[model samples]
Target: MKIFENCHLFHYPFEKVSAAHWQKYPNEYATHVVAVDTLDRKVLPDSQTLYTERLITCRQGVPRWILKLVDGAQECYIREVSYMDLKSRTLTLLSSNMTFCDRLRVHETVTYSPHHELNATVFRQEARIEALACMKRLANIVEQWSVDRISQKASIGKLGFENVLKQINLSVFHQLPVPSPDANS
Candidate 1:
């Protein structure tokens, strides 16, 4: 099976919830920023900017997934992608969803600069690799539980476990060096 599929797992009508309401849940927001630095280094970094209004939040609860569109140039905070909530103890690619708030219109617009295209490519590849690593680690943990016949708790153990993985990835991603512009030019 393909690791990622493009689909709308949930239908949240905008009439029920407005963008203003969704903006409150910025803590659950995640974004991938792609850029090319001076040294021809491509940087695709994922981050949750709580202080910045650049994220889209869920109107009712925390979003399960956020879809970020990363092209060579122009990064836009598009919409919240919805996913299916399986409530499974183990994290599976099938159980995630990205839901967008009703009021926000989905548009196709690239807002980044073309000058840093190379850096953007590198960033995206690195970030994706890091995310995959985290997912693999979780899969390994789940496999261990299965082998031990341990019952996983959806609320506590699984979520907590995933959070730990995410923290580790973030820490490592932050430490990556940004290339100087002169080197690329």
Candidate 2:
């Protein structure tokens, strides 16, 4: 298994960062994400936390060598679960690949927390990739490809989120409608 981790400091408060998340989709940088469907959503009994489950469909490039070995489609599906706690002022997202799970799997976790000193938010991300193919070389190639794809997506997702954060009008956050998750481009 291959693992990756990254940390980013967003120069915005946790409240803003969390609020911006509702509208991060359909951004220019996230072209690979095709569709996102909300599978379930609920608030805990106390109403201090919100839980959500979503299915994300994304299409990305697969290396020719890997494609020759495994006949799979480029489009992939992912299951994402998110939790936001108002009392703790924390947000966590966990995602896993649903497609091609027999041969390869990627599990990622991202958390956002408030910074102690500043009104900023700290973002931490970790990803674990496993290639379960019998061939060693194929496994290596698949893991590497998955790692690279994750890295690229991480950067793109960050940029897209930053843009969303900048555009959020805190006073009228409830009025703005979130764009459709469907990516026509």
Candidate 3:
């Protein structure tokens, strides 16, 4: 699994602009803007704007999707936005798939003071790794169960215990095996 990190500069219009103007540069004026973050705060090449009227409503509402892909072949999908607080400068994001039940959660805070410099690079790195791990585990489980079920059904000529096991393995569940007293003894 590979984690792709994207930093966006979200711009909300303080005042309304003409529909024609917006249409001309819809990507520029839309609230859900995406731009790659540089060490010097410059936008990256090939990054484009996404204008989703359904997801964004000017400056007053949260967009349905906060991140968009600018590059890469990763199929990573965002599961949920756990929390976002500007006053506290904290954000949490989680991602998971149903196959392997792999899940990743990330918590990060940003602070800026007149006397110090703030950096978000480390936090971004950590969050990307966590997300990738979750995706990888889930994908692996899904792939394995698919292969097993196909083979088992072909060989056994029936969908029974093996099929059930395959279904359980693909679900988001955890089970603990317990030992009987006699067996333990």
Candidate 4:
């Protein structure tokens, strides 16, 4: 198992940051993300927390050393579940790969919250990789490869969010409406 953690600061309020997060796909910074299909979305009646489940397809890079051992495409499907709490100004996301679970699995979680001291929003990400294989030696190699791939994905994901925020700022500056679905709508 491999674990990784990271933190990012966005120069925006919690509301804007949350909005950007929801609209992060279809952005230039996220070329690796091929498709995103929302399987379920709803708001809890009592607390009004938004819940969503999405299946995301992404293309990843396979190390040369590992590619020789196994022959397959680098594309993978991931299941993401998210919860947004408007009252608390917090968003939590959990994601896990749906393909090739017997060989490799990556589970990631992210949390977004308001930064009172900095007057910004903070993003925290944690990921765990499990490489299971019948061969002991192959498992070690796969584990290291998984670690590198997850790191690369995390960096790209952060940059994608930042780009979304920039676009929001630009729209506000030019008096262009930043298009986003209303929470109630």
Give lDDT tens digits, candidate 3, residues 1-185: 22333232112121111111122212422222222111122222444322121111122121222111112222222222223323333333332322212443322222111111422111221122233343564544434433443243223422232343334444424564657789957
Q: Provide the lDDT at 104 for model 1.
A: 18
TM-score of each: 0.19, 0.86, 0.21, 0.86
Q: Per-residue lDDT for 1-185 in model 2, tens only?
A: 99988899999999989988867787898988899899999998967889999999988777777665557588889999999988899999999999878778889999999999998999999999999856566788678777887888889889999988877855467787778778555
Model 3, C-alpha of 120: deviation from truth (Å): 16
**TM-score-best of 2 and 3:** 2
lDDT of 2 at 138: 73
Cα deviation of 37, candidate 4, in Å? 1.0
Predicted model with the maximum lDDT: 2
Model 4 regions more than 4 Å off: 64-71, 133-135, 176-185
List clash counts for every candidate, in order.
Answer: 27, 0, 0, 0
**Which lDDT value does model 2 have at 89?**
90
How would you encode candidate 1's per-residue C-alpha lDDT over 2-117 as one tens digit per residue? 12111111122221111212222212222222321221212224422111112333122112222221112223333322221122111111111122212112221111111232
Overlapping backbone residue pairs in candidate 2 total: 0
Error of 4 at 132 (Å): 1.2
Clashing pairs in 2: none
Instruction: Let me know the TM-score candidate 2 reaches against the reference structure.
Output: 0.86
